[model samples]
Target chain A: MTATRRTTDTLVIVIVMLLVWQALHQVAGSTALPAPLPTMIYLMHAVASPRFAENTTTTALELAYALVLAYAIGLAIGVWMGAHRLSGVVGEPILVALYSLPKITLYPVVLLIFGLGISGKVAFGALHGILPVALLTMGAIRAIPPVYLRSARSLRLSPWQTIATVLLPATLPEIFTGLRIGFTVTLLGVLLGEMFASKSGLGFLIINDMSLAQSEDMVTVAIILFAFAAIANALLLWIEHKLHRRV
Target chain B: MTRVGAIRFAVIVGMIGALELACRLGLINHQTIIPPSEMASTLVTLLASGSLNADIARTLGEVMLVIGLSVVLGFAFGLVIHALPRVREALDPFFATYYAVPIFIFYPVLIAIFGLSAIPIVLIGVATAIVAMIIATLNGLDRVPPVLAKVARVHRLSPVTTALTLQLPAAAPYLFTGVKLSVSYGFIAVIAAEFILSPTGLGRDIADAYADFNNRRMYALILFLLIVATVVNGVLHALDMRWAERRSGGRS
Candidate 1:
């Protein structure tokens, strides 16, 4: 499809979504769900508030910490397992099972260990992110063509050189995909941690508004999160596509 | 068992044994986490007591309902979309970014509209799961080879007959993938919804136990859920592998 057509289609979807929101608001009543226009207006003011800044900063910092830990640890595990065949064979299924399991059940244990603080949220977010990164990075390494490694060996390249030249570029696209997914899930994990227990952050703000019957504020936060996730994903996806094309 | 399987079992056992030793030796705090053995025993006792039967039943029933609704509705929507190229093109971006958006954030909005009831929980579950099914359905339909259509035309078969006999069988593997994803997503969403806020269910019971500092009960419930998720996933995975093998074997 042409770029213009795609843009128009996206615009149409946005309009349709707004229309649906309005119709649902009508049906559900203003108390339950404020109309889209007013919610958007509320969101603008809310974003300008100091409380929003504080909570958003808290969530962003947690996400950043979690992403760094997740990437570092996950890449280490992935490289070790991927390079060692036996470990990969034994560990892959275990990782897959962990990935599939609903990890929210373990949040209580996380809470107990880390306490009701930012560390707990960061740990939980990292827990959500680590598996996907490790799994994908492992797959990427395993997929490296044997001939490339053989050539690297034949050239007498040192271990560092082999990884820098042959290993990195070959796996960059897939690793980037892993990072993208890791970012998405880690954000979710942080938000969920906040919603369940934390005293601040967008998730907590949503819950607080819910309890206070502040429908517009709650909707506004959800919309902001939705928009943030959508835009971030689109940007990452575009970069991923470019990387794939280069490869 | 194969060598890898045996080694995998050993590794898992060793890890659990190490954790058990740590818990027993006070290297780990008992207040924070109970030993695995204690968790198992507590779970067995809890099951025998029948105290959690209602909650278990309620949670499982909601999951099943969510799965049924998502699969049926998602497949129907997928079929409609696949039949319309324009609509599919328009929806492509939405599908791509759907899971990234943390649909659970809307759970509160759902609760507000539907009230704090099963409706919101089920809706959230379906919302999380249905997209996977729809994407899988689209993939399955797209892979139905042109030769199948040609064969149907040559044989003068009805559209429904062609769909049932040729398209359905051809698309079965992809459809099964959809079911697998839907099941996992459904389980996660429903439990998470209940965990966040619900009147009653396994998730709620676990939350309540945590709030009351009932470590044993919380650990037992957690173990139960982990076991259930693993077993269900293992069975589905095995079936998927068998189907994959059969397909490759037949081709060879």
Candidate 2:
């Protein structure tokens, strides 16, 4: 797979996929499988909408708040659970149960509790977001060998002192994995909540377009989401890489 | 057994019981924080009325279809990539990029392609699953040390034979891990897609409950959702443990 061959391979896959789409559209009709050209057209129309910008910003703001809050809460719990076996036992299963559950199923309850506002999105996002970080953190902390802790204890280090000097430094790399997973999930939570129930947000905009049969606008909003995800992931990856390199 | 597990179960149940009693005793707003007793009644009604059953069945059908297709296609795709070393290297970055790109972003695209239907819901589920499966397979390939590959070459082992014997078994741990990961993510992806894009199923039922402000019913549904999560997780965990034992040379 040289660059040229890679390009050809990609092109072939795309062409074949598009051909299949075209065939499906021809057979099933536009109501079901609207061809690529129409989708692209709809996306172009959607990008030109003033409301799209505002909605996208609203979603991003909610997502940011959720991610930050989840990071803080999950990191604290995760570190504690990781450092202590008792806490891990009491907490880890709960975290997993929460994470494994169809979080969207909680959307109704969240909506009732938080109302349909940015706060609701943030709250729901955090609920969906925190478990991964907490689990990951607990795991990383647990992975640190007991010998290091014993050595610190032998040196008569205080609990806090051991955590600060030994565990913290040793587990920083693994802890970052929790952060990365937590952030990605926070975004997903925000997006899903917004899409399902919101007055403003990129997800809401997409849903709105769909209802109005504005396929192009729906496509555009989708594209914006794609761009947002790309930027967010790249940023997280860079941060993770930087931290790893520094340590 | 783990004393830790026993204690945790007690603690969790105690918390639930405490919360239920407090709400019942008016230590909290019973309406806002419905007691488990009331929630359980609501649950009975929902199940009796066939709403939960229908919703779960509908959602499960779509998810199962997606999982079935993805497993088959994913394994095939993995095999193809393994067969073509250069192609695997070339596709690696693209796979990583797509994997990092959250599948929720594609919800709108799904709707555009399939409308508010189960097809889009299932397609996105499969898509979310694909990257993880591929990664697991690729990771399995890494278990074949370079030395082993060289030896295999010297001994003239067919690529197919080498793959069936060495690569897959070596990859079993990772593949199982990937399965666990994919199922969980796939669960969320399907529900989220349906919640956002489709007009039916569990997500819709939950959303409708919110819109209607039926708190008791909502609480009931959430409890059931929690049950589903716990059961699925337990199953996955048991499977992982079994595989781990077998993989560790039958230490169990």
Candidate 3:
């Protein structure tokens, strides 16, 4: 559990992964599955290219838009349902059902409604994100100790002041967990949308490379995405741990 | 049904009716979304005709295969890793970050390696689902009371017997949770892989229907998938809740 041991373990895992990659490349051939070293080199080149920058920016913009929509709508619904007991009773199961359902099945419907554009991708990504954010946020609010609200009332705080001082701080940690999960799923949703139908973005590039038999480029892009996701999750988890400790 | 259950049912029916009415009134475009009734009727006809029997069987079979493989293999891995404290500690971060990655992006690469067959689909599904089971197994094993081990020692039970007779039943609830998760994840991953790119399956059928602009067929297929997913998940969730309640009741 020590930092040094953890670091060493991580290094070992990385080496093991590289070995597996190399073994697969050997078995599958370089044309099908490029070696890790070559893929890393290709990744460096790909990252520097104009095409990479453009596609990354497009994906980033779509992700940003989707996150904004997800957070706004999710928080609104969560707060409402969490505060209103009747609505929560009526709506919670429905939301849970929708959340469990394979939402990818509905992507075509999203495409039909939003059309084959950035809007469709953004909407699909937001759709994946909204459920988790809303569910967790609602749980967070409902979990707030009754004493907190009573204390706020005793202080004669206004509704706005009560929410700001008591409710917000009480719920922030759990709500942030929701946001972290939402961030992950939204990225997935956006990638899926692009993979299925899109002219640009990292997902499109991946599919494009596959069709063109650009094995190295494809592997590079996948690795880049893998690294990005892993690093972001680590950062978020660190913050989450800190938040939990604070509370 | 209870009052809340009745109200929930009514709310769902009301929403479906509203959609049907909107379609009937031309308020919503039929091209974008068919009426719920029409989707149901089409699905019934689709089923009666048996045109999609093969696709349904294939997809469901793959899903079953995925669930079975993931649960067994994941539990095995979990057992091995749990016994190895150092390895488990190392793997904690990987497990935490696993689901955060868009794993489906590698489907194409898998296709390239495996030559665009069911192998890739099954592999991806297992990759997506197995982690949940492993984590669940770890959690379940962790929660098995230390006293259970002491009792096993007192009884002079072998390690295998202890695992089978004591650990398994105690951990059944959490293991079931893992199964529930694995089922959902397996279902989603398989369908998504098929949808993205595959020779044949429900996902492929939907994709093809969309491409051919067969809105009726597409909507029916989509509806079928949603219904199946919802029902399966509902059943698992209900079972999970029942087990959870029993566990709590026993504790109290």
Candidate 4:
């Protein structure tokens, strides 16, 4: 397809989707559903609100805490486990069990344990985020090139030295993959915590808006969250790509 | 079993037994974290009474619906992207953008529009699966060996047969990998959806239990959900391994 036709097709999809949304809004004719334009207006209004910065900052802080903790812990355990096959297998089953457990169900346990505080949210976020990182890092460590081990040994490197120089470098790509997965899942977890377990996060804002029947305000917040996610993911991807190239 | 397997098994059993013993001996709090005996008894009771049994059925019903829909819709769109280069190129960026834009962001809107039903959950699951499927199919196409393409040409195979038999089979492993990943993620997405907005199902049950600070109830619900998720995927993994073994033997 030519660029023009491709662009047109894209526009068609976007415009058509919006038009349908707008048409439905018109038919509803209630505050329950705002027209596309009205929603956009509300979105702009949300952006202007000082509360936008506060909510966004709250989510960002919680997410950073969760992501960092998950990565640090997952990497340490995953590297150790992945270094040995037997350990990997035994540990993997337990990890998989924990990982697959509908973490949402644990939120109650989390809330109970941590008592509706940031501690609870961060703990929940780290739990959601940690498993994939560990698994992915394990996968990465397993992929370490054998020739590097041979070379390191030939150079008379100690076990620690070999691991630091050869294994760590080789695992960087996979480690990044784990971190990316951790970020995505952690964001989800953090958002859920904020929504269900908090009084002030963006999630709280959303639930509050919904309860108040502030439909447009809710959508605005939702849109901003989506935008933030997109930007965060894009930034991570760029950094990962740069790291891969540099390494 | 091999000695190593037995040792591994022993280690795991010992760990669990130790934990149970700790709780029993008052080294751990059974109320805060139930002893294994208590947890097992709870499971047994719930299963016998059929309340938990029915709850599993309820949650599993919705999960199955989502998975069923994802398989159909994911493959349909995936095939379109695979076969049609024009369509694939045009939609690629949109898919990439969508991936970055957290689907959870849509939950509030979905609940508003659909009102906390299974439909919204399924939609989220299916949507999560779609891009993964398309990427898998596309990547699989690119993975077809050049030698295989030449062999297909030499055999004078029709284009359709080449796609179905050669390309699809070549892509089979990756396709399976994609589906597996998608299903795992799709399940997570659906559960999270329920946890976020639903009025019923496992997610809602957990939230309710949390609100009451009933650790036993909360832990029991989580364990139950874990078993369901693990059993479903474990079964799928077994099927996949069996299929691979048969195929490898045939090739040999």
Candidate 5:
């Protein structure tokens, strides 16, 4: 579709959805679901509020810290396991098992170990992301074509030289795929931590509003969170697309 | 066992033994880290009490329902989206971006509407899973070889007949991938929703254990969940490999 056509379609869909929302609210006649106009206005107010700002910053900071830890540790482990036959054999099954299992099961354990704080959230987020990153990175490295290896060997490239000039470039796409998933899972982990137990953050705000039956406030926070996730995903996707094009 | 399998088994055993030893030696707090031995005993106790059985049945039922509904709905939605190129193009970015968000945040709204029942839990699971299935189905459709379409044209097959006979079978592998993801991720979302806010199921048991400060039960439940997830994933993976082999054989 043309860009303009696509934009028009999206606009039409959004308008129709808003109309449906309003219709439902009117039909239900429930205070639980305020009208869309009011909800959007309330969302704007929530966004403009200093409290929401603080919460957004807090959640973003926690996510950043956790992603950094997850990326660094996961990358290192993936590289080591991928390159070494012994390590790969010993670690691949365990890592894959961990990756498949839901990491939310460990939230309470994290809370116990780290306590209910940003540290606990960060720990959970990192745990959530680390396995996927490590697994994907390992897979990417292991998938390097045998011909590439043979050529590298014939060229007599050192380990560092081979990694930098060949392996890194070859695996960049897969690595980015892993990173993208890692980033999203990290956000989920932090949100889980906040919801389960936390002093502050978007998760906490949403949960708190829900408990208090602040329907408008709850919806507003939810929208804000969705917007944040959407933006972050788009940004990462754009970067990945650029990298893929370059390669 | 294969050499790699044996090595991996040893690595797991070594880690468990190390953890047990650490707990026994008081290096690791038992309250925080319930050793595998204790967790096993707790699991046995729960089994004897029949609570574990009940929880397992409830959770399994909810997860199955969610996965079944999502798979059907998502595939249908995917087919419609694929048929309508304009709609697919328009909504592609939204779907892609939506996948990244933790849709669990919507559980509250679900609760308000469904009012603390299995409905909310199932809805949450389906919502989380359906998108992945839709994406996978679309991807599968896209992968149907152009030659198949040409062959269908040569046969003068109706579009519906062509899609049903030629395209869907060719896309089965990708569709199965979506099913696998939906099942696994749906399981996760359901359990998480239960854990977060629900009255029954394995999640409730875990949350109750947390409330009671029973580390053993908590660890036991987590361990059981891990085993279940691994088994489910393993089964799906085996089926996927078998399907690939059969599909290749059929082609040959």
Candidate 6:
């Protein structure tokens, strides 16, 4: 299909969906099921409110800091493991176990150690983010063509030169994949922490509104968050597409 | 034992021993980090007490229900979406971006609509899990080779027969992959729901333990959860491998 046709199709579908939702709201006539128009209005107001700005910044900042820490440590460890045979073998099982293990189960442990604040949330998010990056980085390095390494060695290139010219470039794609997955889980981890225990942030806003029985406000917060997440994911996917094309 | 096995065993033992030593030497606070021995004893005590059994059963039942529901609904959704090219194209972007949105965010809305009960919790799990199955199922069906369709037509098979005999078998692997992903995703979603919303279940108990600062119980519950997750994943992986082997053998 043409790009314009696809865009038109999507818009039509979205409109139909919204109409159906609005119809349901009208039929239900429940406070919980606010019509989309009203919900959108509430969302607009919420967006403009200082409170939303503060919470948005708080959540974004938390995610940013956690992701940065996770990226640095996870990249270093993953690269180290990828470079070393024995260390990778020793760590592989533990990494796999931790990967499958719902890291949310460790939220309580984090809370205990870091106390109830952004520190705990950041720690939890970083923990969630690290594993995927580490695993992917290890796989990427391991999968690098042995011929390239052999050739590099034959050239008598220094270790730094070898990594710069070969390993780093070769592993960039997989590293991007890891970053994408890590960003997602880190976002979830932080949100989960905030929901479980927090004084502020989007999660807290949702929980707080729910308790207060403010359905409109709650939906508004959810909408804002949903938009933020959807946009972030789309951006990452676009970057990946561009990078893949270049490669 | 394999070299890797020996190394893993050493790592675990070394970490636990280090923690135990730290506790004994008063270098680590018991309030923050419970010794491995104490955690083991607590696990034993909790098992003997039988209090954990009901919680485990409840969580398992909820997760099983969610996975079952997700499989059925997701398959249907996939079939519909796949059958309609325009619909699929229209929603493709949303579906692609959907996974990153923490479906947990919908819990409050669900609770508001359904009230504080198992209904909302189960709904949350199903909602979170169904998307993966849908994507997988669509991909599975899309992968059905055109040659197989031609073969079915040559045999004068009805569309229904063709789907049952050809398309399904061809798509079985992808469907199984969908189901496997659904099971694990459902497990995670259900546990998370229990933590935030449910009044009872293993997650609630863990939350309660955390609140009370019962480090031993908290660690013990987490350990049990880890075991369950690992065993389930291991079983699914084995099943996947066996299925692959059988398929390859049949092809050979």
The digit string of per-residue lDDT tens for model 3 on B83-154 reads: 799899999988988999999899989988888889999999999999999999999999999999999999
lDDT per residue (tens digit) for residues B65-178 in model 6: 999999988987887788899789888877887788877898888888777888888999998889989999899999999899889979999866876788778998999998
Top model by DockQ, which number? 1
Between candidates 1 and 4, which one is better according to DockQ?
A: 1
Segments of candidate 3 deviating more than 4 angstroms: B151-160, B250-252
Ranking by DockQ: 1, 3, 6, 5, 2, 4
> Residue-wise lDDT of candidate 2 within B92-144, one digit each (tens)?
65676675566777666666666667878888898887678777777766675
Clashing pairs in 5: none
Q: TM-scores across all candidates?
A: 0.98, 0.84, 0.98, 0.86, 0.92, 0.93
Which window of 10 residues has the lowest lDDT sum in candidate 4 chain A? A24-33
In angstroms, how far off is A33's CA in candidate 4? 4.1
| DockQ, computed on Cα atoms, for candidate 3 | 0.84
Error of 4 at B162 (Å): 9.6
Q: lDDT rank, highest first?
A: 1, 3, 5, 6, 4, 2
* Higher-ranked by TM-score: 5 or 6: 6
Candidate 3 at A175: error in angstroms?
A: 0.5
CAPRI docking class of candidate 3: high
Query: On a 0 to 100 scale, what is the lDDT of residue B53 in model 1?
Result: 92
Interface C-alpha RMSD, model 1 = 0.7
A1-247: candidate 2 lDDT, tens digit per residue = 3778877866776687679767866865665446679877776766677776678678778988898889899988997887678888777777777777778877766776687789989998888778988888888889888899899989999989998999887788778878877777787788777777688887777677677766556655666677667777778778878877876
TM-score winner between 3 and 4, please give it.
3
lDDT (Cα) of model 1: 0.93
